[model samples]
Target: MSEILARLAAVEEENRQLRQEVEALRRDHADHRETVGREIASDRRRITALETPAPALREKTAEDHVNRLFSEMRRLNIRQTTAKDAARLLGVSKPLIDKLKPYLATDPRFLILRDPHHKQRHLIRLAGT
Candidate 1:
């Protein structure tokens, strides 16, 4: 029947238009997903940068270890075999000796202070035996 054919053709045209709209929506969704992914990557890089602390903290920690051990050795009145004594023991800068002397107070066998009046001193002292 002619009426049946017209109805079928109208349905097919509507189906085709719906398919095109669905394809457009899919492309839009894909583009949005790409944009969101890029934003996530950029935010991740920013978070990583902010989470990381930039400092010579490790070197400073080494310095503190050297200071603590040097003071402990001095407080215990241990004899030094070499300038390398504290340097070798703490695995830190042997040159720290020169830098630390102004703060170094001693009684021949005693190390009196490892104070960095200009900086916060990280001191760990061992009780004398």
Candidate 2:
């Protein structure tokens, strides 16, 4: 009966060691999961930054929209139109049409004139059109 008691003590010690090992493994897995989550968050922020355009690039895109509006006007043979009308026809925002005012004023191929009937309105027209 002494040998049986010794064998039981050995088995209990082995079980305790195995429990400690399992707890250690669980802790390691939790740490790894936290590290991976942080990495994923950092990568998402990097991707968002890469996707956003700088202010200068955004202005360039708006200018491209203005150029497209000009092409559309020419194609449609529109001699004159209001800024609001142009915005509607081009499927762009009104602010973009407002931004085009300076370019149109300086292009020489186009003209900007005040609307006689509306004090706060203006007209854009192709030269000689």
Candidate 3:
């Protein structure tokens, strides 16, 4: 009977130790989760701050800059100029030529014509509306 009591006590102690370990693990997990949540919220706030436009930004947007360039080109009556040429005239990156091309392609000001007797190259001119 004494041996049986000793075994029962040992088993109870083991069970208690296991329960404490489990509780500790649960607490650690909860703390880790809270930390991760805080980090994610901080990242989200940082991203939001970056999303807002600066107060000292330019009045001329990319589209506006492109439009101004086109107006300058028409005023100068300079046709057959490549995208690089326009980019130079506008003092912007060359890649912006691709971005602005779509707007000017549909405009009536654009005239796609081949030079006389020369099918190897093409010239873009401004046709009168």
TM-score of each: 0.46, 0.51, 0.52
RMSD in order of candidates: 10.3, 6.4, 6.7
What C-alpha lDDT values do all the predictions have? 0.60, 0.85, 0.71
Give me the overall lDDT of model 1. 0.60
Supply the TM-score for candidate 2. Answer: 0.51
Query: Per-residue lDDT tens digits of candidate 2, residues 17-45?
Result: 99999999999999999999999999999
TM-score of 3: 0.52
> In candidate 1, what are the lDDT values of residues 30-88, reduced to their tens digit?
99999999999999999999999655335555456556765767766764323356556
Residue 15, model 2, lDDT: 99
For model 3, the stretches where C-alpha displacement exceeds 4 angstroms are 31-67, 71-77, 112-125
Clashing pairs in 2: none
Under the 3 Å rule for N, CA and C atoms, how many clashes does model 3 have? 0
